[model samples]
Structures are given as C-alpha cells and as structure tokens.
Target: MSPHFPSMAEPGGRTLGDEEVAAAERVIRSGMLSAVWGTEARALEREMAELYGRRHAIACSSGTAALHLAVVAAAPDPGDEIITTPITDFGTVAPILAQNAVPVFADVDPETGNLDPAAVARLIGPRTRAIMAVHLFGAPAPVDELRALADEHGLVLLEDCAQAWLTELPPLPPRPATPLAAVPRPAAPLAAAPPGDAGVRLAGTAGAVGCFSLQQWKHVTCGDGGLVITDDDALARTMRLFSDKGWDRAAGRSHASFGLNYRMTELQAAVARAQLAKLPGVVEARRRTAVRLLEELGGLDGVRLPRPEGHAWWLFPLVLPGGGAREMAAALAGEGIPARAGYLEQPLNRAPVWSGPVYGTSRFPLDGADAGRGPTAACPEAERLVADTLLVIDWNENYTDAHVTAVADAIRKYRPRP
Candidate 1:
C-alpha cells in the first residue's frame, strides 16, 4: 500500500502547533480583536517589515487586499494600463480593475510561466502606469529587468509575492555602461534601504512594493491575511490609509481619501505571528524535499523540471514540452499522487471574467480598449502552457523523503516516452 501524501489543507501538512493555539488565546484574553486598537497586528507588521528588510509593512484582510493596496499606491487614472502575466491568480489582476485601470496581458516565459520582460517591454505605451509581476509558483520573476523598464518609463513596479514566501532572488546585475543622460530617471528615487540587506535578495524587495499572502494555503496562515512592504514612506502612508477606509487616525475622526476596510484583525495577526516564527524551517524543509525530487527526476526526457535556484517550491511544476500534461497528471493521480494539469482551467487572458460585464452590467474602462478584444491572441505562450504543457504537484513543507520518492517514481513512470 502507498503511504498517504500530506497536503496543505490538513494539520499534518501545516506547521501549526501549540504556538498558534497560545497566540489565539492571548488575543482572546486581551479582549481586543480589532487591529486598529490592538498591538498584535501592529507587531506582526513590524516583524514582517523587518523580515523583508522594508521600511514599513501594512497588514491587511487578504492577499487580494494587499495587491489592491499596491494598486492604490500606484494611483492609476481610469483606463491607464498595468501590464502583468496571465499565468497568475486573478488577485494580481483584479486590483488593476478595482482601481479602474486596464490590465494589459503580457506573455510568459514558456518554461517558468513568469512574465517575459521582452513581452512586457513590447506592451508598454503612453498610458502604461505600472507593471505587476507575480513570482509564479515561488520561482523568482526577473524583477531587475522589470525594474529597469519601470525606471525608464516612470512606471510603478509591484511584486505579487503571494506564492513566494521567502523565495530568494538573484543578485542585481552590474551597472550598465550606458551614458548617464541616456539612462532615464526613475519616477521617484527609492528611499534608503534597511541595514544588513546585502546578503539575500528576497522576492518582495525588488519592486516599489511587495505584496504577501497569509491565506490558509500559504506558507504561513492566519486563515486569511496579507502584508505589503515598501521602503518609501509616501507609498507606505498611502497604503496604510487605503487599508483603513482612508481614515487618518492622527486627524480627529476625519476622512482623508478613498479606501476600504481591509485591515487584518488581531486574532489573525496573532496566529500569523506564530506561523511566521516557523516560516524559515518550513521553507527550508520544502527546499530540501523539492531538491531531492529534482535529483530523482534529473535526466527525464520530454519534460522540463523547474530549476531549483531561489525557488520556494509552492507547487512542483513540470513542463511537458511535447504536450502530455493531462495524461501525466492522470497517471500520477491514479497512483495516489496529487497532481493537476493546467494550474487554471484557462489562463487569465482567456478567463470567463473577460467575457462578462466587469461592473454591474457595465464594462466601463474595458470598453473601446484592446482589453475588449480579449488578450488571448496576445499571449500564445501562456495560453499553450495552461491548455497543454503545464502540470503541478501538490507540495508542502511536511513532505518527507519517502513522499518525494513516491512522486519521483510515479513521474518517472508516467513521463512521456519517446
């Protein structure tokens, strides 16, 4: 009989322990459940900010809220464009629409399913206001190149790190040899970076603001929560205000600007704090097991394994270049290995949302725009990835060496034959 594979949905797969329980009790006993009046959420913010080496971290209701906050910081006018990949959670694109901006779908790298920088460069135009990049399945996006484009075009760059907790990024490339005048100035100079940041470049620190998720399935969980980190004081202040219904606590009961009630509660914050404490161990274990599986499946044909460098291993993805993901997933599932073909039924460019009215029977900003035509034609690589090439296996920190072996055996058996 095969051993049971642990999953993120259950306690066995999660790192939750007595620590999380005690945190909940502490918050309950304090009689303060609201973040606005509680210390727990504020403390969580401080810890997250410090962990990411950012000047500020604002805790919010969900990952979508965090992305929404970043969009708010961009302050897009109606119909302004924000380019992003189609291979990510809708949460990454919803925020653009929520802020009345048009999302321009950019094609992804065929292998990694991350936004292709060259594709993004092609889409940038007069009305382009920002670029939102997702580090898909914890593989680092090429933020250094994306940042360069943002700087050149005076665009805001937002990193969606929901699936990328502790995902390390490559070091910045050496300075270009171009003349100073030829290099465009950034929209705003980044503030002084935090101390001791020269060692590791984590996923969230490369852009203007990095958004993280604390949803139930994330590396850490508080049921549903999020945090956005940034070094810019102005961006930090804007996000803080937006998360709290634009209320300025410093100004006596006065409303400051447009916003929402996206604040994280004390209970959620407390639980997340406990989970955060265990995050390093969680990520390390995941890396260890994922790398082991990579080794086991090293020389396979007709499929490409994800490169382990700086990957958090959210889901172990395989790209069957010859196109048999569906069959391979079915084979793995038959052997009791949890796997799925196509992360989504279809990429976001072809999502059903695009076929319907976005706002109460009105498309508004989408009307008379390239978006109305649907960007499906614009991102062939992303479309093919979702419909044919991609496969993802459920992964978590609790996976053992035996589990990795089981997965490798099944994949080796089912991999397309020449």
Candidate 2:
C-alpha cells in the first residue's frame, strides 16, 4: 500500500500541542479576552517586534486585516494605484480595493511566479501610490530590486509575508551608475538582519511594512491572527489606531480617524505566542525535506524545480515548462500523493469579480480611462503559468524522509515523458 501523506488540515500535520492548550487556558483564567484591556496581545506585539528587529509590531485579527492596516499606512487616495503580482491571494488585492485604490496586476516571472520588477516598473505611473509584493509560496520575491525601483519612484513598498515565515532575502545588489533624484520623503530603514542571520536579509524587512499571517494552514497558527512590523513610528501608530476603530485610547473617548475593529483577541494572541516559539523548528524541518526532494528530482526532464535557497517551502511548487502539469498532478494523486495544478483558477486580473460591480453597483475606482477596467493587462506569463505549467504539492513540517521519497518516486513515474 502507498504511504499516507500528512496534510496541514489535520492535527498530525500540525505543531499544536499542550503548549497551545495551556496558553488558551492562561488567557481564559485572566478573565480579559479583549486586546483593549489584555496583556497577551501587547506581549505578542513586543515579541514579534523583537524577533523581526522592527521598532513596532501590531497584532491584528487576520492576515487580511494586517494587509488592510498596511494599506491604511500607505494612505492611498481614492483612485490611486498599487502594483502587485496577479499570482497571489485575493487578500493582497482586497485591501487596495477597500481603500478605493485601483490594483494594477503585473506579470510574474515564469519560473519563480514572483512579480517581475520590470513588469512592475512598466505599470508605475502618476497615480501609483505603492507597490505591494508577495513572497509567493515562501520564495523571496525580488524585493531588493523592487525596493530600489520603489525608491527611485518614491512609492510606498508593502511586503505581504503571509506565506513566508523566517524566509530570508538575498543582499541588495550594487546601485546603478545612473544618478537618481531623491525621493519625496526619506525611506524608512530596513530591519537589521537578526542574530545568526548573517549576510542575508529577512523577507519582510525590505519594505516599509511587513505583514505576517497566523492562519491554521501556515507554518504556525493561532487559528487566525496577524502581525505587522515596521520601523516608522508614524506608520506604526497609524496602523494601531486603524486596527482599533481609530480610537487613540490615550486621548479621552474620541474617535481619531476612519478605522475598523481588526484587533487580535487575547486568546488568539496567547496561542499565537506558543506557536511563535516553534516557528524556527517548523521552517527548518520544511527546508530540510524540501531540499531533499529538490536534490532527488534535480535531473528530472521536462520539469523545473524550485530553488531551495532561503525558501520556507510553504508548498512545493514545480513548473512543467513543456506543459501537462494537470495530467501529472492527477497521476500523482492517483498514487496517494497530494498535488494540484494551477494554484489559482485564474490570475486575479482574469477573476470574475472584476466583470461585475465592485462597490454596490458601481465600479468607482475601476471605471475611468486610467482605472484598472477589468482584465486590462495581458499578463501572459501569469496566464500561461495558471493554465499550463504550475503544480504544487501540499507541504508541511511533519513530512518525513519516507514521505519525500514517496513523492519523488511518484513524480519520477508520472512526469511527462519527453
């Protein structure tokens, strides 16, 4: 019989245990569940800030909420644009729409499925307010190049790190010889590489704000929670206020600005703290197994393997450059291995939501000549990836060498024969 593969949806595939249970009990015993009056959430923020070496961290209710907070920090005016990859979760684009900003879908690199800096640079125009980059499937996006591009254009750069925990970014390349003009405002300093992270930058640190998720399927979880890290005091304060209905608690009973109730509850915070302690181990195990699979499949034909360097291996992605990813996925599944083709049904630019009214019967921000106007860009690379080349196997820290071998054997058996 084929060996059973573990999945993130089940307990056996997760890291939760007595520690998380005890954390929940501690919060319940405290008799304070709301973050407004509880210490757990605040403590989580402190720990997150210290971990990422950021000056501040704000805990929120969900990964989407964290991205929304980052959007608020960017302060995009109605109809301004945020350039991002089409290959990411809708959560990445939702915040841009929530703030009445048009999302410009940029093409991705064929291999890495990351936003191509050249594609993003082409999309930037007078109305562009920010650049939100996602480290898709835990592989570091070309943020250093994106950062330089953002700096040259004076755009706010937001990193959606929902899928990347402890994913390290490569060093910044040498600056160009061309003399670029100064930005409208000084850019915030990137977070210093953490101890033992010598010579490499962390994924979320290059941008103005880095957003992380604590959803159940992530490397670590508190059911559903989020954290945002930043060095800019003003941006941190703005996000904190926005997450709490714009109430500046220090200022007596007055609503300070437009905001939402995105605060993380004390219970969630407590559990997340327990999970946080186990993050390094979780990522390390995932890396170890993912690299092993990469090594085993290194010489396979008609397929492209994901580069293992600094990847947190959220999902093991493979590209069938010669096509037939769907059939290969089916064959692997028939053998009891978990795999799927086309991470999304379609890229966001081609999503059905765009063809309909965006805001209660009006396309407001998406209506004008310069507006997004539903599937405007070709994004051919992203389209081809979703329709033909991409395949992802469910991955988790619980995967063993035997599990890796099973997957490798299955792939070797069913890969498209040249």
Candidate 3:
C-alpha cells in the first residue's frame, strides 16, 4: 500500500469559502474593479492598522510594493544607505535599488535566521539612513535592541514583517545601572501592566514602520497584496501618495513628486477583509500544526525544526543536519510530498543583476568598487541556508494529526547518511 496521504500532498488549495465569494462578487457587481479608494479598501486598511496597533495602514498591490513605498517614504533621496539582511527575498532588496540607494548587506544570526542587531550597529556609518530587519520564518527579531541602535544613530528603523505578522517580541528585563552607568533607575516600583501585556509589542510597531504581505501562501491570503503600518502621520501620507501615483490627499490632487501605481484592487481588498476575519483562527491553527510536527520530529540526529512562536506560522522551514538542502527536497518530492527550498531564490547580493553594469555606476558602487566588481565577500551563511534548508510550503489551518505523522515518518524513513 502506498504510504502517501491526501492531506499531506496539498495543504493550501482551500479557498475563501461562500461568504468570501459573495463579498468579492458584490464588489465586482458594483462596477468598480480598479484601484480607486473605496469602502472595501478603506475598511481593510483600518482593520489591519488596528491589528498592528498602528495609527495608519496603506494597502498596495504586493509586498514588494509595500517595501518600495516604505523605503521611498523613509529615504526619499539618492545615495542613502539602508542596512538589510542578505537572507531575504530580492523584493526586500529591490526597493533599495529602485530608490537608487545603496544596500549594505548584514549577516544573519545562524540560529534564528534573523538579522543580528549587533552587526547592524557595526554597519552604521555617516551615510546610513535606515536599518531594515526581516523577521525570518515567523520568528520575531530582537526589536528592542534594534530600536535602541537606530535611536542612537539617529537612523530610521524599518521592519520587513512579511513573514512575521502579529508576532510579539520576548520580554526584556530592565538593565540595572552599573558603577559607570550613564543613567540610574527610579526609586519607586512601577505599576505592573497585564501579564501577557508586559512584554508584548507587535513586530513592526517597534520600528519606524512595518510592512506585511498578504500573498497567496501567507496566513491571510489576498492572492497578492501588502500593507504598510506606521505611527508617523507624515510618513503615512507620503506612502499614500507614493502608492497612488503622487496624488496628495491633503491637496486632493496629483503632486510633482514621482510615484508609482502600486495600489491594491478593490476585489483583492474585499477578499482580504474577509480573510482578516479568519486570521486569528488561521494563525492559531498553524501554530498548533507546527507544534505537532515538532513533537513528531524531535530527537532527529540531523534535522532541525523551526522554533515554535507565539504568533502565525508562515512557513515550516527545516534545516538538514548535514547541509544537503537540495538533495533532501528532491528526495521528499519523489515521495509525493511538496517540499522545496527555503525561499523562492537565493540572496540578492549574489544575483547576477546586482553585479551587472546597470547598478555598478559611481552613484551605487558595487561593494565600494569604482567599477562593477562582484560582492566583496560571499554571504556564506546566506548561501549555506539557501543551499541546505528544506521548506514545507503553505502551512494551512487544515493540517491533521495523520498528516503530521506522515511527514515525520517520511523524514525518519529517509535518514541521509552524514
């Protein structure tokens, strides 16, 4: 008998359901299908903003567009430098080049696969304008320390929350003053807030702005959409104009500043709004599924399960013990399991396009070279993960216990020799 189970083969084909279909149809029936500001779009922005505890939210066509708008709103000038991790999708780095700003690659912590705030602090220099930290694989980064580094350097902090929506940072106790400490603590004890409330701050809220993706595989699917959340009113307005092709909301007209047509469609917004209603449930389901899988796969000599988090699970990425990511993915695919590499592609720093003459101009030196020389050094950690991480795609709210067992059984059955 074949060991394959139907549930494990395809996890995310489940669509929005009858109510969502009805909502989308109503929008289509209204004869307003384009990117004009409408009820559906506005409602999604409002609800998403409330979810992240931000003052404003702007929806765009894709996560890449959200990053572009955020970068443009934050930098707004050529030759500015933004420090970002090399382990992310090119979409994160594309916005830096789109604005003609230089991207300084920062290595990630091998354990968390997130940006190292210490590396970011070390990279800060005179031209540093912002630090964009990616919360890789649904785990939150060290937000408090990153914010402190950003504040000390007087630079903007941007969060790539595409993978980590609604994820909260761990509580950090207040540091005690030492003999040479610059500041001392107050004498009176502060009133305790709520229990969970004591340490919780949403991922993007810690930075100057946060961007989220509502793509097909994300926890909340909008087919293809993104949102930018920020407490800065001016930055919010700037993003609105940038996303709407330079239309100034205050003046109610198109402005001279260059912008793009990155607005999300009304239909997408309507579908997303419906999905938003189910987001908390979906996130909880993903978390439970991840826990079950981790338990089943525990004690494996070479494989590493993603650390469980308090929020949504976007992707369940496993690191092979011996570093043969491609080999493991191919082996799993042969067994009718839909496993693949960790990301859509490798890091942007190693892409040939980045090394080409187009981006090698004096304005943007390729690794500080006068000519278009290759990257100064290979991003070994990024390369290792790219070469060795196997990704189980599109974790859904419908995973059963049998499905988890099947996955663990397969991994155990096919133990690769070191």
User: Candidate 2: where are CA atoms >4 Å away?
Assistant: 173-193, 369-375
Error of 1 at 29 (Å): 0.7
What tens digits encode model 3's per-residue C-alpha lDDT throughout 167-226? 777666777766767556768886454223455677888887899898876767778999
Give the per-residue lDDT of model 1 (tens digit) for 159-263: 999999999999766776998789887889876565444668899999999999999888889889999999899999999999998999999798899889999
Q: What is the lDDT of candidate 2?
A: 0.90
User: What C-alpha lDDT do the candidate models reach, one value each?
Assistant: 0.91, 0.90, 0.75
Cα deviation of 248 in candidate 1 (Å)?
A: 0.4
**Residue 2: error of model 3 in Å?**
7.5
lDDT of 2 by residue, 1-418 (tens): 3588888889999999999999999989989999999999999999988888789999999999999999999999998988998998898989989999989988999999999999899888998899999999999999989989999999999999999999989766777765466434447776556754666678889999999999988989999999999999999999999998899999989899999999999999999999999999999999999999999998899889999878999999999998898899998899999899989999888888877888999987888735342235679899999999999999989889999999999999888888
What lDDT does candidate 1 reach at residue 160?
Answer: 98
Error of 3 at 10 (Å): 7.7
In candidate 3, which residue pairs get closer than 3 Å at backbone N, Cα or C atoms, i.e. clash?
A: none
